[model samples]
Target chain A: MNVGIVIVSHSPLVAEGTAQMVRQMVGEEVRLAWCGGDPDGGLGTSVQAIIDAMESVWSDAGVAVLVDLGGAESNSEMAMEVIGEPRSARIRICNAPIVEGAVMAATEAAGGSSLATVVATAEELSPL
Target chain B: MSKTMTRLTSEDMKALIGAMQAAIAENAERLTALDQAIGDGDHGINMKRGFDAIAADADAICDKPTPQALSAAGMKLVMSVGGASGPLFGTLFMTLGKSLPEDFECGAFADAFAKAVDAVAARGKSSAGQKTMLDVLYPVSDALAAGKSVGEVAAVAAEAAEATVPMEAKRGRASFLGERSIGHMDPGSCSCSLLVNTIAAWISAKEHAA
Candidate 1:
């Protein structure tokens, strides 16, 4: 299976919109899931939602999480904590900007890049 | 008065949560104002939202043993608050919960608090003097480690929080503002101080009542 991508944002619209852009850039070769909003459907990221999204798009090839803002990063870390073990070992949180990072990482994943390479490709965008 | 309790009873936990909720509510606007100066102006609102979730679930949270109650409260904050502090503070409580025994002594609580502070620092890749929550958290944890009384710890935390006002931002969104971040209190530090002080006050009140 190709590598997977999970988009995390405080705003549901931002996550969905960024996922749409990644889909357009990478096509159907990569698996993708987007999670955003609080448990109450308000602005904020949810650890449960991030965990669920990661599971939905899990891949043996590896999964990369792109998060919006600091809160999303914090919640994503909590999700990873509970995820544990071999699965947690396979996932990585990218430090690049959410939208651009998702697109770049998805492209690399679609090409069957390893998790580290995909993350590196995305992080390379930081200087831009 | 000697505060000798090793473990906070469920009732004690409830009181602490109550005090925290009230403090956050009282300082919400001030937190927002602080954030507006150097970061996103939503620290107060975000903290209030997280604490409100804790309050809404207080009945269930307080029914559990201390560790479980703390963990539950942390989870609620993680799910409700959507800012950097959400994860930072969530991890703080969750780690503290995980580190504690079902019944713990003050020294045990100190160790747990230190672990929780470490977890938050690692999560944020932050350190003391970054003008983030760590500015407050670091001192409080240190005081706890030193075996200082809760009142003394709270006093140290408040001083550290206030000291953040003149420090340069080295992490988080505020760091983007560079030197401009100075002169503004870090919102996370303010909230952290408020929580620590509330806990101190609650414990003192309980001691007085006895």
Candidate 2:
């Protein structure tokens, strides 16, 4: 089974735009979703939305998340607490840039790669 | 003059929470002004939003055991705050909630607080002298561990918050400013001190009343 991918950003438009790029680059085969914005659609990431996105694209092969900023990463980590064990063990947040990482992970997932492999492939794009 | 806390009642805990909430509200604008100089300028608004959410359910939260109430508030912040601080401060309270014993004691509180501060450092991946809340937290931890009075520790916290003004930012959005972040007080540190002072003031008030 192919790994799933999700993109997270602090802005609604940024999340959607990144997801768009990932979809266009990796084709429709890779399961994918994106979420962002605060509760009232302000410029902030929501842990609830992140959890929903990850579950929306969840696969037995696992899901890899790409986050745009600090809030996205921390809130994504908080999402794991809500998601609990078993299913959460397979979810990983790549430390790479949101857009590049989502595209790269999706590409790897498109090749039917394992979650570990997909996450690793995307993480390789992280800046020093 | 120093109080050795043996039994912390739910009533006292609720009052502490109330005082801390009010203190945050009072200094909201100050926090915003500080963050405006070095960060995205939403620290005050975000902190108030989380505290306001907590206040909305204060009655029920204060009715629970201290640990449960703290954990509930921490979870509220984690889910609702929507920023790096949400998780950071949430970890602080949640860890304290999880670590504390059923019957509260000063020594136990000191240990739990130390562990909570360590969790915050891990969550932020930043340590003391980083011009973050850890700056104030570390001093408060030290004072608590040393069995300092709440009033004394509160003073330490205030001084620690002020001490951050001379340090350059090494974490968070402020870090990007490098040298420019040196002269300003850290917003997180100030908020941490606010909570400490509020708790101190509340305890003193209760002691005087008794």
Candidate 3:
């Protein structure tokens, strides 16, 4: 499976910006998703949007979810709960340094590395 | 809050750097565990990478005066480390280097350290409740701004860092955990507290020795 990447943020700008940076590190293979910055509301509709996106990408590989802000976070949790079982198994949530984590994870995934490897590399960006 | 100064020398910078290095190395597993739960589990790996780089240039950094050495170290981390924390943290130290005086005093460092926190926030676009490292960092900065001594800041920062546990993540990987994130402290916040405490301890020890 070719691992997928999802980035959720409070602002579309942040999500898109981080995606652009990670794309440079990982190239064309990774999938990107934004869960917030919806003009109509908060992360309300974005949750369904991400869930829909995840549904489409699961066949490729496990999906990695990165979120921004409180509402987006809560919404992501809802998505995870609803998207149960095998699909859920393929998904992981990364919160540390989003841009840094995404870039690291993408680079590792692009290199045909395992989720563990990418996740490990991505976590290095966290402050703790 | 009391009037004191942080008179750092080249030796002091080295010690602070050393403390950061040791903290990363020693806490690698714990850091990774925290990350793996909410993130990709490489907090230790990236920190090790950045700190290892810092250590490699230790002698060169130590050769310069305290502020210069600290600045160089920050620059090195930003340039070489390929993660968000690298640049964000690198900016922090660089800010400190810029704000700190040659004869670094505690009072000056406290003020400068607060500025350093601002730099990190600007770089990361993060704040205390956002559940990034700033969760710990903000409280510490506020303590310093309130004129708390290094030891005082250290205690408060450490407590604040620990308090991150049980708080739902407002940002980062743990954010996905939603409510689950509430029970766990952010690895970044955890490490940031270590950084703050290290600096505070260094300052306090220096004062005691003097």
Winning model by TM-score? 2
lDDT of 3 by residue, A21-107 (tens): 887766777755554443234222244556766676565468777665544544455456458876677688776577777787777
Clashing pairs in 1: A71-B83, A71-B84, B6-B104, B6-B105
Error of 2 at B181 (Å): 1.0
Segments of candidate 3 deviating more than 4 angstroms = A1-128, B1-6
In order, candidate lDDTs are 0.87, 0.88, 0.71
Error of 3 at A91 (Å): 32
Report lDDT (Cα) of residue A122, candidate 2: 90
- DockQ agreement of candidate 1 with the native complex: 0.69
Write one digit per residue (lDDT tens) for candidate 3, span B54-160: 98899899888777877888866654443445556777788888888877444686688888888887666567787788888778777777777667888987898
Per-candidate DockQ values are 0.69, 0.81, 0.03
lDDT of 1 by residue, B1-210 (tens): 243556677787777888899999999999989988888777888899999999988989999988888889988888778677778888899898899988776778888988999998898998887889998988888888788887898899889988998999999989999999999889998898899888888878777787
Comparing 1 with 3 on TM-score, the higher-scoring candidate is: 1
Task: Point to the candidate with the largest DockQ.
Answer: 2
Give one digit per residue, the lDDT tens place, for model 1 in A1-128. Answer: 88899999989999999999988888977899999987668777888899999999997888999998877888898898778887899999999999999999999999988999999999998875
